[model samples]
Target: MTAAQRGRRVLVLERANKVGKKILMSGGGRCNFTNHFVSAENFISANEHFCKAALSRYSQWDFIAMVERYGIPYEERKHSQLFCLSSAKDILNMLLDECSDAGVEIRSHCELTSVSALDHDNSRYQLKGHQNQTPLQLACQSLVVASGGLSIPTLGGSGIGYDIATQFGLAVTKKQAGLVPFMFSDASKALCERLSGLAVEVEVSCNNTLFRENLLFTHRGMSGPVMLQISNYWNPGDTLSINLLPDTDIIQWLQELKQQQPRSLLRSGINQKLSKSLTSELQALWWPEEADKPLAEFSDRRLSEIAQKLAAWQLKPSGTEGYRTAEVTRGGVDTAAISSKTMETKHQPGLYFIGEILDVTGWLGGFNFQWAWSSGYSAGLNV
Candidate 1:
């Protein structure tokens, strides 16, 4: 029934009016809650095993089972991303319903004033927030910090997750916005602006890591699936390489075209594999003068050089869109001090950290929400 009915105490503090605000907006309204391709390696954490324990305890199949229970029709898209037949609200309702079933009390619109441990043992916590008339005080045997990270502030993202950890003598890793769009500098901004609305399938590289997907050009900067994937690894002033032609051996393709059509324009030869707008933009960037040159006039060495340039077009991003537009936060509460099996703080008993608040962050797609499901279940079951 209610908290009073069950005689079990619980308090879930939600800063915004909407508890699952981000959950509603994710995956273009259909929540990609979890994926079939899940492993400890897919996540980044201070202690890799921290996620392994929880994830193994509550696997992707567990969430899928719950989804099946709700009878939410779903389909597997590319990369094993599962989308709801309707909207993300179904997933949110499922979670809320589960929490209710467990006799969990969700306190919405309640801004946490402060959190501190009660005694030397640090077994109990004191939580302060405004209630019906005045500031209210809450003492609990356990405190679970699932407040999330500082991404999409409009969606109730906050550092409140970190604050609780810090107050309890826990370590928090450096945080940053990730899986967000990249913005170019003023000089390069003009080119990106000029090519706005043009999207092409390409391979994007940031240092040793590379991602192959569709890249979109925006008036402000770069986005789309590929760019968003690479943005997680991109840092300020770091060089990024874009392969304009992903699958084609540009030189060989052009050589054959040159023999077939001796008077063909250089742009036309490249356009056979690439979009005309993208080909024009790349040709302007690579060989502006040769944009009008006949393919027959090009030598093998020149073609090879063009191929190299096309395969690797490097540019350094000035910065990213930051937490406001970030899909998920990069860092959070360090996992070293927390128990991997239980998600409980080692030093502070009954103190737990789960979801995006912890250091574990997953790649784009359904990974992050998977972390939430696994980690949340771990804490919920154990606590």
Candidate 2:
């Protein structure tokens, strides 16, 4: 759109028959296009400050204004994450409409095979690939690879972008699954399986980072916002400390409840604070050999131990669901080789890498899409 607006011919090569498959699937179809609040703090990148310039140049307010210009109704969700009030189609359509106005030619089902410099001076780029099942090639003064990262392979997420960076003699970083669920360790697998489908508001922490959000139990492992957020900072063999009852002082609550309901069974009193199913599972896991007795009969030390366990329950995850379910990848082309201001490689002029192809990975919100817009626009202005 920027190239065409500048009176330059523009072409958009898409590998899919449709242009916005991922956009349509984002935010459960509502499409969290951008966030009301965004800053360098929201992203994770090898060069930590690389995203600042582009983001500042094309801020979230810029995109929101554009959405408003197109009359697309949107709503602000949790943490200022903005979603289309109607559907993701609205955002996609707005993009398409802008491209149309700019006379941008969109060729769908275009798969790139190779890219090489046309001249020794790197005057132009030669792009050879198949377009709609037909062989095609291009010679352009500039090339922008926004091929995204390895996340949802079903949606065409792969290492193609990293492959391109490697082909260009640039450094690519180690990549891993990000914003993914955690698989349970052997010791916790059975309990997680038994409590599958149960959800609790929890504060989960790992590596000095913490997130308070919903924690969901799955047959395979643990998931939900809190788990997903903490997974980004977790490594293999790391144990996550979780507070199931983050809202209350568990020790005091239990002591008071025991004083008032001395005749109540331990499970029953705990059940008052948690679900019956969860209480039963906890009893089996924490005190399996012990008999279910009145709260008055249990020793203070036993209650203290139970309280401490609930306050800082520690569990190590086995692994993750991998790219199949991850929202984005952890690493990509090293930012040290690229220019933060223009999204262009310093070693290779006229060649740009934007969006998820870069090492910048945002939090699980609309931050990723915002990076795309900001970085793409930065390259567009320069290209």
Candidate 3:
């Protein structure tokens, strides 16, 4: 039987709102559709190789083709991030249109009340929901859970994915908000507040993983591309080291500064690269007593210490801004329970999970959306 003749009823459960709520708010309104370089190494999950199958099946080029087919103009930003020339609505329309063409029924404004499979007919599954005062029951041979993760609750992201996984004897990894802003220490918060709206190209590191991008100081804490990327690896009480001068070797550069202006004050010399307020903060931290002293008077050891401080300034974050401000959730349904090729539950047949519902979390740039399309498409094809 053909797909239509098979009468294969498929139900996709979306919360009362809509998909692409987060997409609309991402990248300053223009959605970063996908990234050029999407490797398994960039993703984080319990089973490392699990992402390889779906990613290979639906490559970045594949997503770009679909975007191009829709006549949506896109441009490559830094780090090969593809963004729509118009708005994020184009991408949403593409996904909805694909579902329509495939005869997949999407039920919005309907919350999933419960889901269970028939004990006798293992291939049969039932989904319960409500449209208004009347209840709705959807029965199908295949059931896919694409409810997403609990990141931005305002956008309708929920923990329903894990809850459903647990109902079916699936394991859920420890979940936390990823790609979020870092909340600073009291001292650091004050300093960040002083430097609010200041952004510089620098490197941010956490747990040995380094992100080279722009770090923006916000009124509440730290954000921007670099900080958001590194936020995945960061934990409370962990120090986030910042390399203010990532390209220029501070040690060698300081030596050059010594040769060029031997009698200049340390703060005056650093003023060339760092902001005046930031320079003052560093001077206060480095040389509170002799902050006004000339660079020529400093010994090699003191200069080395100062250079090291500038090269890698460490700050312990109090916590993250949490789901309210996070771009994605870090962990979810463990990958080991699902087949990498089809996203079907290994323990339970005819059951599938996709999108942010899985543990796999991508980097800041368009990678997560790529995972969504890839994993969603994988299950869509098989289901």
Best-first order by TM-score: 2, 3, 1
Q: lDDT, candidate 3, residue 240?
A: 88
Q: Higher lDDT: candidate 1 or 2?
A: 2
Cα-based lDDT at residue 327, candidate 2:
87
lDDT of 2 by residue, 311-373 (tens): 899898889988899988888999998999888889887889999889999987799999999
* Candidate 3 residue 125 C-alpha distance from true site, Å: 1.8
Give per-model TM-scores.
0.94, 0.95, 0.95
Which regions of candidate 2 fall more than 4 Å away from where they truly are?
A: 120-123, 185-187
Identify the candidate with maximal TM-score.
2
Instruction: Report how far residue 353 has shifted in candidate 1, in Å.
Output: 0.7
Once fitted onto the true fold, the runs of candidate 3 whose alpha carbons sit more than 4 angstroms away are: 1-7, 120-123
RMSD of each: 2.4, 1.7, 2.2
Better of 2 and 3 by lDDT: 2
In model 2, state the lDDT of residue 316.
87
Worst 10 residues of 2 by lDDT: 115-124
Candidate 1 weakest lDDT stretch, 10 residues? 1-10
Which sections of candidate 1 miss by over 4 Å?
Answer: 1-8, 120-123, 131-134
Enumerate residue pairs that collide in model 1: none
